[model samples]
Target: MIAYDLMKRLKELGYIKEERDPYWWPKSGSFEVVVGAVLTQNTKWENVEKALENLKNELGSIEPQKIVEMDQKRLAALIKPAGFYNTKAFRIQKLVHNMLDEYGSFEAFQKRPSRSWLLAQKGIGFETADSILNYACYKDFLVVDAYTARILNFLGYELQTYQEIQEFLSDSILENLDRIYELYGQEMPLSQIYARFHGKIVEFCKEHCKGRDQAEKIKELLV
Candidate 1:
C-alpha cells in the first residue's frame, strides 16, 4: 500500500482527529516538543512524559533560557526518568544555549529555524531535527523513525535509508494533495499534512506492530 492509502486508513481508524495537546507529540510550536524530541531518543514517550512533568513542576515552564541557566546536575536529576539523563541534559543545554545565542529565544527560533543549524547541535540527528522542524516549528518536514522503517518493510518496500523512506511517504502525500483536501474537506497545509501523517504512522505501528503476528496484522489492516 502507498503512504496516502495508509493515511486514509489511519484517519478512518480515528487518528489525528484534531490539532491539540495530549497527542503523540505536544502541541505544535511548543519548545516542549524540542525538548521531548531530544529526550525521546532511545526511550519511550511515557518516560519522556514523566521527565517533562518533572521539569514543569520544578521550573514552572520548559523555557530554553531557564534550561540553559540551570545547573547540569539539577537538570539531569529532573530528567532522570527519561534515561541517559546526564547525556541528554548536556545535549539539551547545549542546544538551548546555541539556540538563544543564535536566535535569542524559542519564539525567535520558531519564527526562523535552520535545519542545518539544528543538525550541527551535539545530539540532534536527522530524525530528531525533523521532529523539531515538523512538530515544534510546524515545517513541512516529515519525521520518520524505526516504526516507519518496519511498517514500510512489512508493506514490501525496499527503502533502506531514511531519506528514501521519507521521500517516498512525502511524495505520496504531495502527489495526492487534491485527494487529501477532498478527504479532509479543506485545503490543509503541507506542514499539517506531514505532521498528521507521521503521527498516524507512529500511533498505528504502536498499536499493531507487536506480537508474533505483527506483520500479518499490519498487512491485514492496511493492505
Candidate 2:
C-alpha cells in the first residue's frame, strides 16, 4: 500500500467506526466542539472533557455568547483542569468575541467561516481550525495531528508540514473511496469519511499501532 493509503488499510483491519451516530461528534455543531477544539491543544482529550464538564455545569449550556460575556478569570478557573487555562480562556474569548461582533451567532459563524477566518483569529492553528471546521461545522477539511504525522513517518514518508500531510491524505483517501467501498462494502459521506478517518487514525495509533514501527502491525492488511 502507498503511504497515504493507511486510512483504507485501517478500515480493512477493522478500525473504522461502525456507528452512524446521530451526534457524530461529542456535541456536533454545538459550542462544545469549539471549546474542546481550543482546549484540546497541548492537552489530552480527557483533560478537555473535564474542562467541558465544568463549563457545562457552570453555564447550563455551552453558548458562544455566554462565553463572550463571561469574566476572563472565572472562565479560566472553570477550564483550569485543562491546564494553561488562563491562556485558553482568553483564546476562547477571542474566538467568541469575534463570533459575536462579526457573525452574531454560532450558526452564522459556522455558515460562513472562510478558510482563513478562523486561522486569522487569536489562537486557532491548522489542526484546531480544521477540527472546528470539520467537527463543528461539518466542513470537508481533513484533520491532521501528531499521530497522523507519526504513523505516516512509519510508513516511510516523512512529511514536514501539516498542510502537506492533510492535503496529501485527503486527496489520497477521496481519490481511493471507490476502493474503500469495495473493501468495506459501504459508502460514507465525505464529512463522515474525513471525521472517521481522523478518528480511526487516532484510535489505531492509541490502541495497537504505536512506536516507530507502527506500520509493521498493519502490514498484513496493506494493499
Candidate 3:
C-alpha cells in the first residue's frame, strides 16, 4: 500500500485522535523538545523522560539560556539517565549557545528556523535536527526513524536511505493533499500531518511490531 493508504489505516486504528501532551514530542514549540531531541539519541523515551524530569526538578525549567549558564558536569549528571551523558551535555550546551547567539531566544528561533544551522551543530544529525524542526519549530519536515524503515520494508518498499524513505512518504502525502483533507474532514497543515503520521508509525510499531511475530502482526493489520 502507499503512504497515504497506510496513514489512513493508522488513523482509522485510533492513533492521534485527540490533542495530547507528549503526543509526538512535548507540547510543540517548547524548549524541552530541543533538549529532549538530543537526550533521546540512542535511548528510549522513558529514559529521556527521566532526564527531562531531573532537569525540570533541578532548574525549575529547561530554557536554553539556563542550560548555557549551567555547568556541563552538573548537566551531565542530571541527564545521566539518558546515557552518553557527558557527550550529550556538551552537545546540548553547544546547540543552546549557538542558537541563543544567533536567534537570541527559543521563541525567536521558532519564528525563524534554519535547518542548515541545526545540521551544522556538533551532535545534531538529520533525525535529531528534523525532530527539533518538526516538533519544536512546527516545520513541515517528516521524521524518518527505524520504525518508518521497518514498516515500509514490510510493505514491500525497497527504500535504502533516509532521504529516499522521507521523500517517498512526503511526496505521497503532498501529492494527495485533497484526499488527506477528505480523510480528516479538514484542511490540516502539512506540519501537523507529518507530525501525526510519524506519531502513528511510532505508536503502531510499539504496539504491533515487536517480537518474532512482527511481520505477521503487520500483515494482519494491513490486510
Candidate 4:
C-alpha cells in the first residue's frame, strides 16, 4: 500500500518508472561494487565506469589484490578522470591492501562481522560505508547522502545531525535486515529507493528547484 502511494507520487513528479528496474542495480558480494562506491565519491558514475574499465582492461581484474599491487602512479593515471585521482588512487590502493592484509580476500572481507571496523577505514565515510554495506555486503542500512538530507528537509522533515537523518530514515521504514533487502528485489526499499530517489531529486532540483528555497519549493511544487 505504502509502496503504491510512494511510487504514484514519485512517478507523477517524474521520479521513476517501470523501465528503471534493470538500470544497473548492483549485485551483492562483488569487489567492483565496493571499489565503485569508493571511487564514486564526489564524482559521476560515468567517470567511475571509465576508471573501472581502465583497471579491468589494462590490469586484468578489479580485484583488491590486483589493485593493491598495482603501481600507484599508473593507477592514478588510469583513474584520473574520476577526479581527486592522486588521493583516491592512494586511498583505493591502501584500502584494497588493508582488506587483503586484514581479511585475506575481498570475499573474506565481505563475510566478516566487523561492519563498524570497516566503516572506520581510512577512505570510508558514512555514505560510502553504507553503500559498501548494502550493495556489496547486502546488509540492511539506510544510506544518508546529500540528496536524502535535501529532499527530507524540503519535505518538511528537519534533522539536526547526520546521525539523526540516518536514524529517521532507517527507523521509519525497515525493522530488519531481511525485510530491507527484500524491498530491493520487490519494489526498492528505502535504502535502494533513497539512492535513486535522491538522484532524481537532485535532477529535479537542478532543473526546477533552483533559485528557490528547498522547503518552499517542495511544498509549492512537489506537493
lDDT of each: 0.88, 0.80, 0.89, 0.68
Tens digit of per-residue lDDT, candidate 4, span 133-208: 7667656665667766776677767787778987776554544435434534465544455455444554565556
- Once fitted onto the true fold, the runs of candidate 1 whose alpha carbons sit more than 4 angstroms away are 17-24
lDDT of 3: 0.89
Model 2: runs farther than 4 Å from truth?
1-4, 17-24, 209-223
- What overall lDDT, based on C-alpha atoms, would model 2 receive against the true structure? 0.80
Q: Any residue pairs clashing in model 3, and if so which?
A: none
TM-score, one value per model: 0.95, 0.89, 0.94, 0.78
Q: How far is 176's C-alpha from truth in model 3 (Å)?
A: 1.2
Clashes of each: 0, 0, 0, 0
lDDT of 4: 0.68
Candidate 1 lDDT, tens digit per residue, 1-223?
Answer: 3877888888888876544553346756899999999999999988998999999999999889799999999999999999999999999999999999999989999988999999999989999999999888888899989999998888888898999999999999889998899888898779888887888887777777876657777888887
Task: Give the candidate number with the greatest lDDT.
Answer: 3
Q: Report the C-alpha lDDT of model 2 over 1-223, residue by residue, as the tens digit.
A: 3423676667666775545343245776776799999999999878998999999899999988789889999999999999999999999999888877888888888888766988999978999998898888888988899988877776678789998998788878777888766665787667767887788777777676645554765554343
**Full candidate order by lDDT, most accurate first:** 3, 1, 2, 4
Model 3 residue runs over 4 Å out of place are 17-19
Q: How accurate is candidate 1 locally (lDDT)?
A: 0.88
